[model samples]
Target: MHGLVLAALAVLVSLTAAASLNAATIGKANSTNCVMLIGGEIVQGDFEKFVTIGKLLLPGDDGESTRRNTVCLASSGGSLSEGVKFAKYFYDNGIGTVIDDGQECYSACAIMFMMGTATGAEVSFANRKLHVGGKLGFHRPYLRISPGESIDSSAMQIAYDAAFSSALDLIAVANSKSPWSSQPMMKSDLVQRMLQHVGNDMFMIDTVDKVGRWDIEVFGSSEPSLLSEEQAFYACENSLQWQNGLTKGDITYSNVSDGPNGKRRSQSLSKETRQAVYQVEGLASGYAMESCVISRKKGTIFGCGIDEYSDARLGQGDCDHSNFADRSSSLKAISVFNPATKLEDLRTGQAVVAVQSGAARCFVIKGSQITDNEPCLVIHVGDAKVRGRASTITHFVWPSGSKTVLVQSGTSFEINGVSTGKRTVAERGDCYLNSATLNDFCVLTSPN
Candidate 1:
């Protein structure tokens, strides 16, 4: 059995060329000491390199008395075969993995990181700590498409699908042994999204939410970086629905209060089954509410729905809803946004002020992308302070989270009781006025 498996692994490894794999001990086990594996574009010989490095760094002769081994990785993924081989080796050695601060482990490297946990090959979570400031990205198994080669054939298509399935399975296995049930391995939807949106470009796990989904224990000083407010706002706006009879822009000053279960709490939700719903009110058209369902594994918004009516409230179906918009039922008005608009075309270094629902937000414009066919952006919300000049002003506030007011461009407002004309800011207060109101209710600030 062992020989057959080795033979199969060898055959897979032979599919690629020579690879670069480097290893060295950086510290001791009690000190969280680890063997650092640095590689570029995994290849065939890489497996052998791990074998030699494993002996030098974590010798088998050490027996049970030896300190638990930890491995740190900085790689951009190479051969899938080599990646699998190395992951199994790490598991067999009961080795832990780390993506140190300021480092990156993308593609196959991320696989190694995922597998170096209690579930894949390691015994427990005693020494494994995925520090912040490092990047871990995933995409589909990369394959070269020869020039002028058509993949239209059914046989070729089958082969391609098989390869993708195998790749996803490998990733799933890596994440299967998470220490926390709240954080499990990769999910099918997440893998599909990677294949769709990420493509050749890396889908970086930049947020704490994203990292937490993978169940990789984080150890760092930085808070989870806030993603583009524009994207969040867009999600909130498009997700709204007038369920028992509500129209868009018919009213303002809505209040979205998440229920007791919706409020942020100490207990973490299961990555697979986690959900929350907001109870909306204060609208001219009676009561309205929106619910956002997220995939904890990917830390992404999957499906969102809203109900507008005096009696609109969450049903059992709303809490455990699909990530995609529910448009099948005609009883309620629903708008589903899939593969959100790509924000790559948006110019950076600009500011955009947008209002939706009943809240206002100002974003330091960066760019956007359609993640998993969902629109996404990279932006920063401003505070009430003079920073720089103002630019674009989008009218409308989508009521979801907190309410902030944004003033029109070329408008001045007081900050700390002082008048400022050339700054853009996001003030902490609610500004409610009918559509006829073209007033500057919030101060603006610059990016300086």
Candidate 2:
């Protein structure tokens, strides 16, 4: 990003003009590009700073052509919607930006740092550690355990939220839904934009490519988006950790929270333990996972004494424990069915030697962002909506680390950009999104 230096203390010096006074000016040396030295933990407030500084340098679409803006991210991530607003500014202005890896662009920073892509920029990294994981970051969509029976009057604040949320929303929402944006966002689209959303208003969420399918959404690694049966089963069945192993298919469910209740629950609902239950008996979970649904009233079947149903039975609420009840009803359980049994039990952040039993699976929670150097299969329960560097998705699809199933139907070919087995009921081949081999390429599958 240019070896030139621009200290905040420096910008506080050079940008002494009148019109730029109200603006949070950044420093630009010989590079002509603006450099913002981001420090301290990331906050939604910093995003406004990004916008103000960017506007100061590049002006707006209404003004002369916007100059490019580059951010030197060296802090932890904060706020999802805020980051998006900041990034949206760069994106709309056709500005390019970069994130030096040595400077930590932990959470929302990494996503917004991509604003450079608005002008065909790159999500460049410096030469340091890049921690990528989970989207329920410190910014946007704030939450707090309401005081006893006080869910409505819970002590919450939308302090660091940004003002550009409205304008950003109009553009992002349309772009997300636009067909020319390339891939249409399915209702099941797996785009995690909390980093790009606005307001700490969690309920005000956005959905792109609503034409396709989606399986689930997670607030983070440990919770579902809400308590609807749809939300419950969002990604339940897609959680497969192994091709074969003792724990591979040993499905377990626990602590199912009964709707807006939060009195305190300590139990889960799932099927009995069997040798083949969670195994790759025939290289399939046998059949592709249908949008299964479970229920205390409908789906509870007696198998090995415990009741269980297909992965579609995601939101089958059974836990009636008083502890799970809500007072003001604002603090409610988001998941009626938890797809994870022992996902938290695995040692993931460890540096260990490799083995190929494939028993452990990445924590399967929707909307929970995942970034890695190795391969991973991001299974969207219904219709899978995916994006990012192919490595982020391709590796997560099939075991080969090369094969991925994008938007599989019960049978038959879906559309262009997608290729199926030419059968009515066979699994899809590979689906690619602008697949360009060496660095880019995706195996695409969609409905025709």
Candidate 3:
């Protein structure tokens, strides 16, 4: 019996090698602490090799080792069975995954990418990540047969059954809570869409809606950006909805307080100060009355408020600062809004604000002059004292975390006393500080 099982395994390995002409190359990522599975088709041989190396490189059962070691996937996909095996191994080990910018993970590769998990300090979360420029495509699993190969009805049925069984396994893994994170790997709708595409067709997760719905973390996109009047207003409204824990798709916005067809108001303020009193519906029981005060010159949200009708009223009877400070959803909305104005175009003294919630009346500039006191959180762009040096600085206020400052002039800015050149995009965990003031400038890329 042992000899027969060994023989069966040998035959299976031989068949897999013969079928997978272009096997994936698995090795350490260059200049980084990550494992890269690049090119070709995923096969049993490659999967086994990865497991062997992964076990040695990722030996810590405490989850920290797995979190530090990410498997970056860039493949056109190969064997569905092998892909399933890889996914199971990643989930069991609490390994994180990344589809980096300019990379593509399709078909079986997408399956492996979706199943990546990691354990955080307090809770476990889906560590499956997709860069903004990366492409992740999916299609239904199908049996592959050599050209002109003759097969009986029984053999064909068995092959079909195996393919279907693999699909079912994929669904189960997607829906099942991670042993470490206790979070579903992917959304049900994402799986449904994945299976909808047959054979050569592909369902690409290419939009913000799909990305958000699937619970995939996206990075490397432009940030601390500016938005149009319409997009900014929508973001403000969306932030309110998120703070109240309302479903994003359920809420709808209207420019006018009455309805969609209501008459537009002639502005009492200058063109540089845009004001809008919008109505937000699809809340609990009733709708919300909201107002937006924007600085058109700076392309920032100057002030915003939710009225008495808002469900997010935290005893203050209006836009509560606690709600905005409690959640970082608003910062995410700011970063995701498209057709954003460039940061370089912005002038000095112009404030780039994130999300603001307060009880003060929304500011509306009158006739090119400031009328009301600024009620929102503001980060000015000008000369400031940093570590005993007077430098021209621009600061960004994250939702519930520390600030990120951009030094424009004065002293040479060095992260950890090492000059990182003119353009430096800080990583998530990096921290820069002015010892004189103890101001921590940490780069937190992810909104969560």
Predicted model with the maximum lDDT:
3
Model 3 residue 291 distance off true place after TM-score fit, in angstroms: 11
Q: Against the unseen true structure, what C-alpha lDDT does each candidate score?
A: 0.41, 0.29, 0.52
Give stretches of model 2 more than 4 Å off: 1-34, 42-48, 55-68, 120-141, 144-180, 184-448
TM-score of 2: 0.27
Summarize candidate 1's per-residue lDDT along 1-448 as a digit string, tens digits: 5544433333231112224343322323333435545545666566786677666766432333223456777676766756777776665555677777656677777666666643223324423556655667776564544456544445445455645665755765655544444444454445554566443576666543334333345554321112222223233333343222223442222122235533321111232222322222222222434443322123334433344433343232244333234521211111211112111211123354431221223321212211111111222344433356563323222112122333333565332233434433334223222233223333122212
Model 1: lDDT equals 0.41
Candidate closest to the true structure, highest TM-score: 3
Tens-place lDDT digits, model 3, residues 29-97 = 652534554456787678889877776666444634456658888888877778888888778767888
Who is ahead in lDDT, 2 or 3?
A: 3
**lDDT tens digits, residue span 118-156, model 2:** 232332211111112221121233321223633211111
Clashes of each: 32, 70, 1
